[model samples]
Target: MDEVSPEETPSQKVPPWLFRAILTGAVALGGLYVLGWLIAELKMLIVIVLVSFFLSFALEPAVNRMERLGIRRGVGTGIMFLALLAAVGLFLWAIGTVLADQIGDFADDAPGYINDIEDWLEDTFDIEVDAQGLLDEFQEGGAVANLATRLADNLINLGATVLQVLFQILTIALFTFYLVAEGPKLRRNICSLLPAERQRQVLSIWNLAIDKTGGYIYSRLILAVISFLAHWLVFWLVGAPFPVPMAMWVGLISQFVPVIGTYIAGALPVIIGLLDQPSTGLAMLIAIVVYQQVENYLLQPKVTAHTMEIHVTVAFGSVIVGSLLLGAVGAVLALPAAATIQAFLASYLERHEVVQELEDAEAAQHPEREPLGDRLRQMLDRVFTPK
Candidate 1:
């Protein structure tokens, strides 16, 4: 061995206790890694169960209604499930028809549309666009053509995705059927594991979650319908093709998606109108603005506050975090999750009655405090910190 120099050695030896702690931490970290790997492997299964949870809560009311009308609970659950399936099938058919029509129309008029766009550019901006030449270049085995070819090849992957979706749907349906049919029994079994007092709390949270989830889902549907009607009327008045489906798309997207959903939903129709004829997109834009004003100022806050009972800031923040976590699914789930937690906290958590009570208590030891305006401003500043 080489001779040890003073500077070459560690300043101090690690203690036996610290060594044991480090070893324990390393083992705990490895265990966490294994657990995470297992979770990833079961991601789809977990998602199906969670999705079933949401559906069970959302549909409990309808099933109960059917049961109240002299139907058995199991029978009522089955009927509701069938009705849900039918509705989904109908929606898919409508979307497929719209897609077919749009694709066919676009394919047929693509050349004329390109030429018209070029003409518009030349007339409006006094700048000639070689759109026709560009189109020709794209069709002649250039990079754009290769990209298109690749996209066409990738279309086959849709079949695999469809199969996976079908499997998930069947799994969720099976789970939901059992959940709705045996919800009371399931709750009882779950509550049996807890103390009597804790059971009451669990059941209370369960019922409240169901109410909030059902109300939220129904409210979104009603809002979607209203948006669809506005979109359809505006588009039909302007003689847009496939107005109904396009409007349906706008309504659903705007209602379900958070924050920028309205703009995204409105953009599609405007683009279609702009492509179809001049000034039509402007009329569509006007309709979107008017409807949004009516919805935001009048409809949304009332319906949402009635059901959601969440702060506006919290709602926005939840949507953003949810979207960041799980894309579209998180966005849809975010509001209900936040509402559930808010309700639970309101029910159980004790809140301070006074503003700055801690500061006030600490200030009692001091001789004098700041002026009221300064104190108020300071409190407000702390509450509303800048991003």
Candidate 2:
């Protein structure tokens, strides 16, 4: 007659097996937590290893071709790294010399440009703008002063970022060199540690990744060259300074770097174009915009679909996810990673029609409870029906 507590009920008893199970689960969860913490600590190293792997995949085709041409693998690796270093050095040198000069020239020429803009505005729109006055107001309002104060802060932040990036690049270069030079031996060593079936599977996956990564890089290189030529023509015609280097910068960055690279690549050329004339700058901007639109909406999708055999939508999504996980390097690596994953899954997952996972839950919640007579009637109808 007394109210029974659920905890005291016979079915509610904690058996020795259940207790052991709970303890085991708790210990497992704790171990997982520790593992997660350790991984977080090693995240930078993990990113470098992954990026290095991706780069090695991308460059392996060139190394193989060099070998086929009678070059030793070590020499081929050296040649690849040397080329990479030359490009990086050029980029750095251009940034230091050209960019620094441009900034100073910009500061000197800004007032003249402002006057020309004001004169044009007055002539065209009857808007007698005081651009110089506006700039003076901004200066007086502590805006320029604020910029001066923050310049040091920005420089410090930038230096730290550059060092971090250089470190990552160095790690990737070292790993890529080793992978290119000793790939066959490395594969043999790795395979020796695994069983025969696992070794075969690992090699298969590795080969697939290399193929996709090589294809991705090749496609990008082709596009980059086209972009470079197109921009070079534009820059030469417009009389922008350093047309060759500027075009190379735009082409490589816009083609290879993800998301915001287009704007960064286009900015210098556009600014230099403006130094030639406002119309030239506007033309440059328009051309860059149109080209980017074509690349994003047409060229990129077609190339990726053909080369990596990945849908544009999947490639775009993977880039977003990868960028969120590991910033720019992740975005660059994501497409090939997605392709590799698709290839790997295709080897294992069954081909079947899919159903929603929640369907069983819904069916359980809304069970069809029928009367015994109704069930009998249904059974009788089924029995009487033709097979």
> How close is every model to the real structure, measured as TM-score?
0.78, 0.75
Each model's lDDT comes to: 0.84, 0.83
Deviation in Å, model 1, residue 364 alpha carbon: 23
Find the 10 residues in a row with the least total lDDT in model 2: 137-146
**Residue clash pairs of candidate 1:** none
- lDDT by residue (tens digit), candidate 1, 62-95: 8888888999999999888888889778667876
Runs of candidate 2 with Cα error greater than 4 angstroms are: 1-13, 113-165, 292-306, 347-387
Model 1 lDDT at residue 234: 83
Error of 1 at 235 (Å): 3.2
lDDT of 1 at 164: 89
Question: Which regions of candidate 1 deviate over 4 angstroms?
Answer: 1-27, 123-128, 137-156, 355-387
lDDT of 2 by residue, 1-387 (tens): 999888777795567798889999999999999999999999989988898888888888899999999999999989988887898788778656777787767765666767877999999999978686756734545555366667777998889999998888778788878987999899999999999999999999999999989998888887898888988897787667777878888998887786667888898788877776778888888878888888778877777667877876887899999999998879998888998899889977889765776777788899989999999999999999999
